[model samples]
Target: MTLALVEPTVDLYGAWWEAHEEWGPGLHEDGFGLAAGDEVDSPAGFTAWVERVKAEDSTCRWIVEDGQVQGGIALRHQLNEATGHIGYGVRPSARGRGLATWALGEMLNEARALGIGRVLLVCVADNEGSLRTIERNGGVLEGIRGDARRYWIELPAAGESGVLTEKGADG
Candidate 1:
C-alpha cells in the first residue's frame, strides 16, 4: 500500500474523523495534538486546532494511505523530558501493516533535517506494538518509569547509513 505523510487539511476532515471515531473518545490518539478544549467535531473547531498545532514549535503530519487517513505523527521542535520529541499513532483498524514504523522513520528523517542528533520516545510498557515500532527505528531502552518505557534514539548524521541497528537494544 502507498502511504503518504501530508499536512492536516480540511479536505481530509471526513476521513480523519472516521479514523478518530474508531479510536473512540480519548486524548491518547497521539500526534493529532488534540487539546482538552478543542472541539474537533465541528468544522470551525477543527480548523482552529489545525492552525494551532501547525505552529513553529511543532510539525504534525497525517498518515494517508490510498486516499484515507490512517494515522498521524508529530515532531516537536523542542524536547520535553516528559513527552519527548516525537509522538505518533496509527488508527485501530489500520494496525499491523507497519504504518507506524514507516511514519516514525519518516519523522526521524524530519528530526535529523532539523539538526536533532537524538530524541527520546516513551510508551507504555504493555504496548508491544509501539515498543517494537520504536525499536525498529533505532530506539534504545533507557529505562522503565512507572508504566512508561523511555527510549533514546540516536540519528545518523548526513551521509551516514540510515540502517538502524540493535546495538543498544539490551539497555
Candidate 2:
C-alpha cells in the first residue's frame, strides 16, 4: 500500500471524515488541530478548519493510503511545554500498521528542516502502541508527568539518515 503525507485539502473531506468518525466525537484527535469552537461537520466549517490549521504556527499533514485518509501528524513550530513539539494519531482501524511511526519519522525530518535540534513527544503512560511508536523513532523517556509519558528525541542534522528507512507493521 502506498502511503503519503499530504497537506489538508477539501478534496479529502469525505476520506477525512471517515477516519474522524472512527475516532468518535471529541477534539482529542492529535495533529488534527481541532478546536472546541470549530465546526467540521459542515463543508464551509471544514474548509475553514483546513485553512486555519494550514495558516497556524504548525504544520499539519494527513496520512493517506490508497487515496484514503488513514490518520494525521503535526509538527508544532513552537515548543509547547504541555503538548510538546509533535503530535499524531492513527485511526483505530489503521492501528498496528506502523502508520504513526512512519508519520512521526516523517515529521521529525520536517522538524529538522525547521532547524529544531530536538523535539518532545508526550503520550499516555499506558498507551503501549504510542510508546512503541515514539521509541521506534528514537524517543528517549524523559519522565512521566501525571498520566503522560514525555519523551525527547534529538534530531539528526539535515541529510543525515533517519531511524526509519521503510514502512512496515508495528513490531
Candidate 3:
C-alpha cells in the first residue's frame, strides 16, 4: 500500500502503532505530524500532516520483520552544517538483535544516496546500545546536549573522510 494510505488506514499504520506505541512519538517522528496531528487520529488530520511535511531532501521509513514493525529511521536534511539529523529506534522486542545498528546503516546509505555528506546522530548517554551502534558506524563524538550525546558520522565524499566506507563502497 502507498505510504499516504498507511497512516490513515487502520490496517496498515494502526496495527503497527498499537503494538509499538510505547516507543513514543519521538521515535517514529515520521517527518510528518511533528506539529499537526501529533496523535494521528482523523484521516483528515493525517492528510494535512502529510501535505505540510513535504520538505525537500528528507525521508523516514519503518523497518519491518515478518510483516510487523521492528523499528523506524528518519533523516532531517541540513538540520545543521549541511549534515542530516539521523534518528532511529528498534521496538522493545527487537532489542539486542543489532537491528538498530543495521537500520542506521541503511539510513546512512539512504543519506549518501541523497548526496548527504554527514549526519548528526544524538542519543541519551544512558543508552549504551545506541552509543555502541553509532560508534560502530564511525560516528565521531561531537558534544553533549543535556542528557544526550551527539555524534557526527562522515560519509565518503570527493574530498571528505571515508568513515562510512563500509557502506559507501557497496552503497
**Quick one: best TM-score, which candidate?**
1
TM-score of predicted structure 2 = 0.92
Candidate 2 CA-lDDT value: 0.92
Clashing pairs in 3: none
Which residue segments of model 2 deviate by more than 4 Å? 159-171
Clashing pairs in 2: none
State residue 91's C-alpha deviation in candidate 2, in Å.
Answer: 0.5
- lDDT for each residue of candidate 3 in 46-93, tens digit (9 for 90 to 100): 445444444445676666666666666667766753223876666677
Please give, for residues 28-69, the per-residue lDDT of candidate 1 as tens digits.
Answer: 888888989889999998888888888648889999999899
TM-score of each prediction: 0.92, 0.92, 0.70
Q: For candidate 3, give the lDDT.
A: 0.64
RMSD of every candidate to native, in Å, equals: 3.3, 6.3, 6.4
